[model samples]
Target: MTSKEKIISFPHMGNYYIAIEFLIKHTLNMKILTPPPITKKTLELGSKYSPDFVCVPFKYNLGNYIEALEKGANFLVQAGGGCRFGYYGEIQEQILRDLGYDFEFISILNAEDMNPFSVYGIFKKLNQKLSFTKFTYYFALTLKIAEIIDKIEEYIRENIGFEVKEGSFEQLQKDFLNRLKTVKGFRDIDKIYKKYNILFRNIEINKPKNPIKVGVVGELYVVMEPFSNYFIEKELAKKGIQITRFITVTYLFKNHPKEKELIKFSGKYLKYAIGADGTDSVARTKQLAEAGYDGVIHVKPFGCTPEVNAMPMLQNISNDYKMPVLYFSFDSQTSETGIKTRLEAFYDMLLMKREKQKWKKVI
Candidate 1:
């Protein structure tokens, strides 16, 4: 550890930084050095330095670390798990070192299972004042806040497309996020969650009672990170499509262990786990198809092995169940215009299919 004050940093993942900043500021009494929001520059920087074949997340995170390092970050903390993500921190650390950037890299659960003591040990190393009691309190509060935020976002995804006023949901969501940054404790988080929940639920939307529901199933990072997927959910919502995404940090912690059931559901199509979220993707796609969703969108980073393996299985599921599935592979080179055009075509096809079915019923 350096004798000077440490500036800590981590890559951005949606609004996760809000909870993370709160935990660090309150528990460790340390100043957080957050990276700037991911942008085209971030992507360009990441792609410039990253291996051509590596996943897009590596490029994005590396870019984040470089930007933070430039901003005087002395310590970099990264949280990753499942498949290749387990090795990202070590690789990124080595890459930065090769580039002559001096920084301490801390990785949480890269390969090992989640253990509170291990995490506490990392914090203790960072700040001697940190203890299990304080860690537990702050960690629990962060978890609650994360869950609440995810739930709020779920509501936003459902209503954002059909908002009576174009930016009604977005404006309120911006206000909620701004308020979130100033929150200090559990009471503040809980109060804000409730306040925004009501506010979002009350926002006027012109959605049909039987709106087209689309299920999004795919690799976790690509699905969770909006910029990674080019904000596909928001784009869909803009087309008056309701999206159901079952993946969240809460689901990752609470239900990931019972993935045996997902495996069972997917076993007929996929005999083995392809690692990461492949099995879950197959099972969720089948579940959504059987549950009568109008369509399904499969998203993943280009060159991701697990999602690539799931593609054929998804095709089989789509054919067997007679469902429409749209696939998008994202990389730094993926053009927004291409994505928008594809999504427009997919939406029109789904709308036509729905109308044809309705006509059949009328006959």
Candidate 2:
């Protein structure tokens, strides 16, 4: 591959983006292209080209690979899973080749067949020509920033809806991220943490008179990647809707055991794990609805079986709880306009429901 050949990957999750940024910073003469956010169009294009029986995520990623190659990306990176996704790279590679795009593909996996190692190796390779001490120092700093980003994003997801200033959390988050890129050491991380902690903690947030709380649940990728869902959380926050999303890197890596408890929380409603994130999502949505959330948003990649199977059950839960639910299936070509319109309608319905509840309480 030429030194100028670009490596590309789709935004499957937020942490992947952070890891990619770290990798990109270390590689020499290599451009890393992050695919555009998945939308309806992305899904349509993916579905049009992909095998009908393949899962939704496969189609979405396939679309991303094809689109990225068309846009001059000559190298592709696939990372995720010891399950179905572990083998997705080969299938995607073949599909892309059949489509006539020439590219080098890298699969990031560890010896144990778990964890993303190519990501680490890429950074290591980039640091090879430099001082070992300096490389370790910078790599440590980058890892700290990645951890902080995860923590801060979790906080924001849980509380952004209640923020007094509609976009305060997101704006501070952006500032914090920008600051993170400039930090160089442990001292810098501490300073950055303290500064943002105080800034976010001091913001005056009001409890809405009738808060429209919405819980978002679905496949891991679509839930975390803002590009995939078109910034759905931000849109909900702007509408003063309190949002709760159960999936996060922290939950996936550190809290797997707690998932059993969560499954129990879902009661007897959903039995058997569908696949990947399907089981967790169904459980979380049930709990959220029972907890008096005004609405739920279930997002998945187009044609995802586990999520697709959960939809009817979600609708049943919606009907039983009298809560509104919106489903979004994303791919590389998904339409932004349609997503926004559906969200607007969902918000209006939730707001009206809140009003009715308030009136009932007053009576």
Candidate 3:
């Protein structure tokens, strides 16, 4: 089938649309269709059809598949790990079939046969008409774009709280995305990034006297997609809290090996991998605690198993390290106001803890 006849869909993860844009630009006749950003309705739909105890990412992605099918998407692409997620494609496909949706589904990562070549083969199938040379060229460019996007997002998360002007970082981010769309080559990408790097660096920032730092972890989908989580980071930044989220596409795709090393470093504490993202969540929570972060926010979809398994361990880490951690489960009926209130309370508790630490040091 030609690229135009295929529609690629993945769960709402960080900057996936950016990655999709890179794919479309490189492949001829390809049209991309992303599921609408996850919301209360998404969770409701997902929960309605999914097994009650299924992982949250499963429900979310299932909901996405259903929604995309309803919206004329004919091809679904599932990319993830060697755990239950590796098998999600089969289950989700069957569910879609039962729902009477006619579509083609591709699972990119096959646990038993996973290799670089296997991965490249999937990409080749997705764009069968593209020459190998062209595929290599576009893949390289996409990696570069992913790196730049990750760096920019990390910078924003770390510094957005200090912006002297409200929405300055967001506005600049919008401008950066617009500029990125105009980039046609490596040189153009570098030029745009360098210009914006300097522009953002020069912006005056007022460091909060006692900044509340929150480390976010959980099911990859909700944590990575701002829209999926109702812009939770933005709301925290607006409250003048510095936010640190450990999940990024660059880390997941490019630095998975290094992360694997870190997981090994966790050793016996994280003995069994509950699922795809469970191991990473445990390691990240520990790292954040060791880094002296004030608090951690764990966001998961309603039925996510890996994160559910990680939560008890996370609580143990929080207690041992004397750090605060908040857990939030998102679904269609979850109230935004409730989330905001919890965040406000978490922020207040962190600030008070910092004050106590200061007084203790003074004494």
lDDT of all the models against the reference? 0.86, 0.71, 0.76
Q: Rank the candidate models, highest TM-score first.
A: 1, 3, 2
Residue-by-residue lDDT tens digits, candidate 2, 1-363? 554545655534564465456645654346767776555666676677777766566766777776777677887776555236567778777877888777878666422433334344554553465555555555565556766777777677667877866668777877887777666568988998888988888877876565678899988777876766789998888777777887766566545545466567667767665667777777888889889898899998777777888888788888888988899887555688999999999888887887898799999
Clash list (residue pairs), candidate 3: 40-332, 55-303, 55-304, 56-303, 56-304
Please identify model 3 stretches exceeding 4 Å from their true place: 1-11, 37-41, 109-116, 257-260, 267-275
Structural similarity to truth (TM-score) of each candidate:
0.96, 0.76, 0.86
Best by TM-score: 1
| Model 1 misplaced stretches (Cα beyond 4 Å) | 1-3, 111-113
Residues 1-363, candidate 1: write the lDDT tens digits.
Answer: 543777888888888888888778876745689999999999999999898888888888989999998998988887676888778777888889999898788887553645567778888887888889989888888788788888998888877888888889888988998898887778998899889999999998888899999999998888988988999998898889999998888778755645577778885887777788888899899989989998899998898888999999999999998899999988899999999999999999999999999999999
For candidate 3, give the lDDT: 0.76
Error of 2 at 353 (Å): 2.5
Q: Which of the two candidates, 1 or 2, achieves a greater lDDT against the reference?
A: 1
Backbone clash pairs for candidate 1 read: 161-237
Write the residue-wise lDDT of candidate 3 on 152-206 in tens digits.
Answer: 8888888888889877888898898778777678998899889989888877789
